[model samples]
Target: MKCITRSLSCLILATVASVAVACSGADGADGAMGLPGADGEAGVKGDPGAAGENGDKGDPGTAAATEGTLTGTVTDAVLKDPLADVTVTVKDSGGATLGTPVKTGADGKFSVKAPVGTVVLKLTKTYYTDSADIMVGVIAGTTVSIAATMSEAATGAPTVTLAWTGDDFGYGKTATLTATASSPTGSTLTYAWANNTATKIGSVAAGTDPKTATATLPTLADATKLRTEGGVETQYVSAYKLPDRLEVLSIVPDTRGAVSVGVTVTDGRGQKATASASLNAASIQTGLRNVALGQRVYLNSGHDGTNAWTLTTKPAGSTATGRGGICSPPPRGGEYVRGGRESRRDSRGRSSAT
Candidate 1:
């Protein structure tokens, strides 16, 4: 039995030595650490332990992402109706573009994401004035709602239609000019008349009608030229001078024959419209309306034994209103001179001509 026990003990000892070799070194000195193998399956859970006193407060952990949202609606300034297809943008304090511009949807409402801080919200559309810059405080984790109103820009180019009565313009004749202006907004209009060249003839200011102006045909510069060169009336009265005071009409190449009249119209908004027309002057009566009802026309001259022929009105033409026809000198004195030309100045300084 003792022999049997010793053999069993030996077997046990051998098994124990194999386990020790696998677990540790026999030299007793610690060996270099080996790479840790994968953790074994988690051990069975343990029961809760007694709670301990709090240690120390640790530093705060980094915060999660801080973001903001903007929700805004755009409307028309005048009509107060929602406006679509507008571009909404957010800008930093430095005026740098924050992200892509957000376009409004069909509802004229838009929402965009941005970093948390102070930002400017802007709304814009084609042919519209931008809304005033809006400063918004973009608090982290919050959405801001904004209302924007945009105004339509002043884009109306005014147009005008001008008309006038009395095509014929003779010395002492008058015509009326009218201007009608139209605009998209039905805005007020202003009227201005300028010559074709914009120079020489200068411009004329219309009457109070803002649309109506009266033009009085003035007489020729020289009375005698009426009989010679019937055309070539070139000079016009200065625009600054009063139309009422103007009596001398110049027949320039422009007015020498049938002509086109031109005028310009302007609106209160500073838009301009121009037009042109073919116009004919009235038949110019030879005699001045200045003569008395029945005054005889052009009779006397400084006759140095006479072979010189002087311009005299025919019997029927002797009146200031009569047709322009040449005849022999008036049989008697008491004749008068009128119209653009000077008749025989018999009384010198006392002699007056129209």
Candidate 2:
């Protein structure tokens, strides 16, 4: 019995030892857990960059801007200074207004801006006479200056008188009529004279009071006849009468080849007298013939007997001959002798004896 008990105890001890050894082997084989993986390395920060430089400046821009002008002054006749407060206006060639009204300054100066064209500058002042038709030109980008003078206004009635100083009776002769006038206002005078009836000659400006005008008379186209009481056969060559002025004695031609011009002279008191005289034609014809021939000629009984006689050579096959009166024999030429008588008369009826 004692031996069995000892053997049971040894067996239990061996089993215990075996269990302890197995527990020891399991612990050694499995490694301890790595300390929770070291937290991921903190993320590295990005490097700071260098700063950039500024850019360059830009270029300049363009400008904007009108065309041109006309400047001038308005003054009076004396030109002492400019006329102030005068209304100055500019008009185109068609007389259309270009701009607004501009008044003259204290210095009598005014200006206007207009487009390119033909223009007229007009000036007006109170109670003063204005000028007519002052023309100018305005071009692009150009300026023009003009100076104007104004005249004084006129006042009352205009009186006019005319005087004629020329041969009123002659073929192709011109008669001149001059007129003088006196008044406070300006006047325009027109004069007319005729032979048988009234006819208009011409008109002219007599200007501001105390002025003169002139006109040349035209020639008459037809012949006139007259008779005198001295038993003389007189012919009227030409006649002229003033319709507006005065009545004069009748003029006549004398028996001699001369003009008997008559005039009725009135004294300061208005008393009138009749006067007549002979105007010799010899001197006038001699002067006219000398001018025509460019040389001197003989003046006999108021006739240019020297150069008036021209010997014309007849053309071949021509039958020209004297029709009436005395036919002197042809001298040294085969041409026929021709002769005719010429007669002239003044305003009076008279004839030259044959």
Best by TM-score: 1
Q: For candidate 2, write residues 1-354 as lDDT tens digits.
A: 999999999999999999887775434566777777667887889898888898898787754224358888887664345778888887878889877979999998988787676778788876467768678877677888888887645432234444555332332233333334443422233332222112222222222332222222222222222334267533233233212111222333331122333333332222233333332221122111212211111112222111123324533544332211111222232433222233434347565422
Task: Give the alpha-carbon lDDT of every model.
Answer: 0.55, 0.44
User: Candidate 1's residue-wise lDDT over 205-266, tens digit each?
Assistant: 45787667655443322211222124522222212111112233333333332233466765
Candidate 2, 30: how far from true, in Å?
Answer: 54
TM-score of 2: 0.26
lDDT of 2 at 21: 77
lDDT of 1: 0.55
The clash number for model 2 is 5
Best by lDDT: 1
Ten-residue region with minimum lDDT total, candidate 2: 295-304
Per-model tally of clashing residue pairs: 13, 5
